[model samples]
Target: MHRVRPLPNYLVQRYHGWKATGYADNKAWYRRLASDGQHPRAMVIACCDSRVNVISIFGADQGEFFIHRNIANLVPPFQPDGDHHGTSAAVEYAVQVLKVSNLMVLGHSGCGGIQGCIDMCKGHAPELEDKGSFVGRWMDILRPRFESVRDIADDKEQAREMEKQAVVTSLQNLMTFPWIEEKVNAGELTLHGLWNDIGEGSLENYSPESGAFHPV
Candidate 1:
């Protein structure tokens, strides 16, 4: 806990700007949000890419969407062991407590984590293959998807396709949680997969019936 420290000068200045402009202008709304506990209708699980702005792209306002950012937006299979589980805890709390009706897994092009997974699986990134590597271990969730795209002949295409697969895989993994599955089975919850092309600035939604992603 003691490892925490104050922000650097650049980030501090940026925070000051946001606090002065955005936060100050919306003080009343922020205060109301603080008074009334958040009741977001949807939960968006997206990548940690700085360019992929889920809230901005959807034009969602504060307190409207519950967002969780993780590497490649991948969800690991439900593990009940007594250990740290940030992603799983967030999903559980959102579904079981917040009662978010919709859960969207958002993936994006040029995902470094997805690329690392591909490289690691193909023996190109030996550094990530180490047993103690957190990123490597977490990315193992998408390792299976690599094999499906391994023969695509183009590295760029393979990475893009695998990025989409991360969303698909996470949706699959989300159901592994008993609470999530129960809510979904009761028709109280819905699952969605989304992908964004950073360069093109286009969004796509996964079609369950067609098993493909279509532009939104």
Candidate 2:
């Protein structure tokens, strides 16, 4: 079956109309970026969920941010064994090449990947175990966290707290890179862990003092 793609006329017309706005002045400026290369101010590691697109969420102009999206918004520890890790590669380019000033790990509520990990940990998830599956291993990235926060709550409503902890874990993993750690210690780059709660259309900042996500 062929997929239905949005008509080119629709996209082209939208772009042409958007070019008239002051906010979209960069639309043409980005046309020059193909030859100039992208030099974004921030690098965002976000989730692959369709509703959680980082570019549209931040309302950033083209080439303004180097973004990487993966299941559950994960950033695995750096490894070198001839394995191609797309997320890590984007991180390297953003930090090493573009030299972005900020690195953000953005998480959202009601993430299917997070829920999958939660279900697997609770022994109720059966979908991933039957086939030649990598879900078990991929979800291992979140295993330690699930164990850490499972004792705090036993219901879906309380799982929001666990999601907050997972963001903290991702921040900790970010510093595993020597360059990132040095930059952070030297105040060259700032690391942020943010949670976007889709349910209430709210944004939360991870507060170290409270050990919870606080609305900004």
Candidate 3:
């Protein structure tokens, strides 16, 4: 790891502003917002990639969306595990407590995690011999997604297709939550699959009709 770092002047100024957010005149506004309680209308499931900041991209202010992020932006099917599940827990709170009306699975191009999943599925990378290796097992969560789209295309097209399929698969898996499913069926909630092309600053929405992502 790099032992030293340079602080961007822009970030330094932002830090100063954030630090002052709780002082004097700002404190009342903060307290008022907190007292009103968070009632975000949407929940976003996004990747842990630094390039994809959902809040900034959507131009959101505080308490706009309850977000859950993980490697490759995955959403594992609901299951009880002894350990803490940060993403799942956030989802539970977003649905049960926040009562968000919409859920979005957001994916982006040039994702390292998706690339790794592609590699592993093509036999170009090593699989975990056991479930103990954290990262190895983590990517394995997308194994079914990988296999589902394996024969759809070749070369770069294949990779892109895989990434999109992964997003759709995660959105489908999101229904594994009974509360989410119930809400969706009753018209209380909606799920969307979104893909962002970082280089082009363009977005696409998944279309079941065309079985493709359309520019949005």
What lDDT does candidate 3 reach at residue 193?
Answer: 95
Which structure among the candidates has the greatest TM-score?
A: 1
What are the C-alpha RMSDs, in order, of all predicted structures? 1.6, 3.4, 3.9
Candidate 1 residue lDDT tens string, 1-216 = 899998899999999999999999999999999999899999999988898898889999999999999999988899999999999999988888899999999999999999899989889998898999999999988898877898999889988899989999999999899988998999999999999988889999999999999999
* lDDT value, candidate 3, whole model: 0.83
The TM-score measured for candidate 1 stands at: 0.94
TM-score of 3: 0.84
Predicted candidate 2 versus true structure: per-residue lDDT over 104-186, tens digit per residue: 98888888888887888888787754456666666667777876767765576547766676678788878888888898899
* Each model's lDDT: 0.92, 0.79, 0.83
| Model 2 stretches astray by more than 4 angstroms | 1-27, 129-131, 152-154
**Tens-place lDDT digits, model 3, residues 96-173:** 888899999999988778888788777776654245756557777787777667776666677777778878878777
Question: All candidates' TM-scores?
Answer: 0.94, 0.83, 0.84
